[model samples]
Target: MPVQPTPGTPPQATSRQQADSAQRVELGATIRRLRKERGLTLVQLAQRSDLSHPFLSQLERGLTHPSMPSLHRIARALGTTQQALLASAVRADPDVTRQAIRVVRCGEGLGVPNVGGMARMLGSPQLGVHPVEYRGAQTDFGDYFDHPGDEFLYVVDGEVEVDLLTADGRVVHQLAAGDSLSYLGGTPHRWRALGDSDRFRLLAVQNATDPLTGTAEPHG
Candidate 1:
């Protein structure tokens, strides 16, 4: 005799399990993509990350469960930070792709207020690429207002008073024209304008979180 389960329960349970398995598969695929992107073979990754062949194979095939530490090893072998890999995974997963990012402004000689100074994205959407902008600093204060993502700034004009907040807290930096700065986005940073110059311009690059990636990152 067969015992029927409650209505909708069985299907829901199956869906959950399937979703979990799919994510595992995507994680494996992401690892492999990164590996190939870095020109590393399975054996090379095994040696570099201190993982095993059959185990890694199983992971790549999404046929087994891997601990966080194990995944981290694979991540390191691929030469990319783990957070970026995880972010890729989230982006690849349809389950987490509900948000929409529409283009805002697109024109010449126009700038919008970003986390810091004005950001110019007055081109095609592809020019926007990842969610970031070219920011400028004025009056010694920096254009960064402390957000998330790793960042770099190449000074195109003027001097800057760059303040950075890292894992250890706040530290101020004096950046003159042409000085480059790179740091984590999660680090709180505020820049004050400096010298006789009224503003500073820099090409700011950062990989920002989509709404879904937000759950994993901290709120500033």
Candidate 2:
């Protein structure tokens, strides 16, 4: 026998469960794609991340979900941030077919949910380039970490200040809204919002690594 639901009402628990399942599958596919792009086999990734090979295989096959710590380890092993993997999972399902163009609409970018503050990746995934949008009250210089390439930042909305400091704690230059900066990466730098609003938005582009090979291309 079949039971009918009331009008305008659905099975909330079942619907939620289905949504979670779909997300798990999508995340698995994303991880698998990244692993292949980095030329890493399941066994290799497992060894690098210190996770069991069988567990990683199950994660990639959508048989299980990974905890935050596990995901972070996997991301580190893959030479990417956890934010990127999460964004990929939310933005789209795995697409092996390469596209000539990719589009992201207003309010439709992939949010970096795990990261504190508001940050999102703009547009579809592009090779060797990461375009990010950041909206927040301030940024910390201590959080200014280093990676392989260079960076370019533009103030898209509100006002902010950027500081470029030398290794010995000297401020080389400062930038305000409507001003842009480009510097070779590996230099210590950071920024913060200004004015009464205490809000700022920025568009930053930086070099990205290949998920399959885990190698970064030089970007100017």
Candidate 3:
């Protein structure tokens, strides 16, 4: 009797190929994250690489396929060679499904919590942030300074003063929730929880390397 492949079971070769396809998604995400982290907008990247803005946006959004030359150009602009991207893509585990992301409490997981002490991990670990809580007045907020990315704030509850700093130690802007601010990330920054109330709550979303990315605060 001739043997037939099981209806539910994929052949080893087919499985291996599928795994490769999955890695493509991860590679695409990495590309987008790196691009955003560099604070280079699609328009800027296009200008730098001489690529069309639409095409570049599609590539970053993972909606289109980028040719080797195009990828190479983008890589050059990002200051990383194509080989590094390729290596990362290759090292990605095929078993890891990109769509099955889980939302965990900031302090619970090995991730930075955003505002309200809650971090919603969108789809990938690379795509989310949680609320960060700053306690005490005049607190230095160690490890809580300017970082290499942009960040957004949403005041969940309570009150706090968020101060941004420039190279010259000047306060550029200040805000309290119900109030929000967006600024170039990674530039020395600080915040203080204000109000005579017992709780000070705020949500901060910055580049994944914001150091605070892995930490979470409790919502009052």
Candidate 4:
């Protein structure tokens, strides 16, 4: 006969439950680190990801877990992919020596889901600069972005109209194939494809870390 557990003793966690708890803790730490690296407060991250502040706080504390969609939103807001985030979380030592040269073959890269299209990461996170290729079908005027470091955009194909919101007023620019634009950090901007083309392709490069010093301006 097997002996019963002591009275009032709580049941032990199963292996699966233990594994899940470990993962949650790791993921939460990774999220918090990435947020701080981007100089974002929990509230700011919540706003960017369209997630509730309380939920994000709980997630960061490892008291709660996020769904796949929620994770994707967080990844997008942090300017990273889900795979990269997960890899960072699971790695024993992130500071390990990285490969001197990394190569991404044609049509090979981490694909990130976008509002009206897809974005692929062409550069590794260890490079300190993120190079992304965006292919979009529908125009997205509602998607405005502002972040901590400078950004450069090159139109690989098709045309796009960009609106930069400066302190004085909004400035607009029309870009076509072979055209490029660069902007300082913390500038509010939005862009949409021009013409009736089925899709447009753009190459964007941005700093992966916060380059600004002092307090960061609140993003509207």
Highest lDDT model number:
4
Clashing pairs in 2: 37-212, 37-213, 38-211, 38-212, 38-213, 39-212
* Residue lDDT tens for model 2, 1-220: 1224456765764443454455566678989988888899999999999999999998887677665447767987887754355445543423222652546555544444322246666534444576778776444332444444478888876766666666677564544567777866566566666663245777877766544444564433
Name the best candidate (by TM-score). 4
RMSD of each: 15.4, 7.1, 15.4, 11.2
Residue 70 CA displacement from its true place in model 4, Å = 7.6
Q: lDDT tens digits, residues 10-69, model 4?
A: 554233244345555666888898899899999999999999999999988767756535
User: What's the TM-score of every candidate structure?
Assistant: 0.43, 0.58, 0.38, 0.59
Instruction: Flag regions of model 4 displaced more than 4 Å.
Output: 1-29, 32-49, 52-97, 210-220
lDDT of 4: 0.66
Ranking of all predicted structures according to lDDT, beginning with the best and ending with the worst: 4, 2, 1, 3
lDDT per model, in order? 0.54, 0.62, 0.50, 0.66
Give the range where candidate 3 is weakest over 10 consecutive residues by summed lDDT. 107-116
Which stretches of candidate 2 lie above 4 Å from their native place? 1-77, 81-98, 113-116, 139-142, 163-173, 196-198, 218-220
lDDT of 1 by residue, 90-117 (tens): 3433434233333333332123343335
What's the best-to-worst order under TM-score? Answer: 4, 2, 1, 3
Model 3 regions more than 4 Å off: 1-97, 105-124, 128-144, 167-169, 172-174, 196-198, 209-220
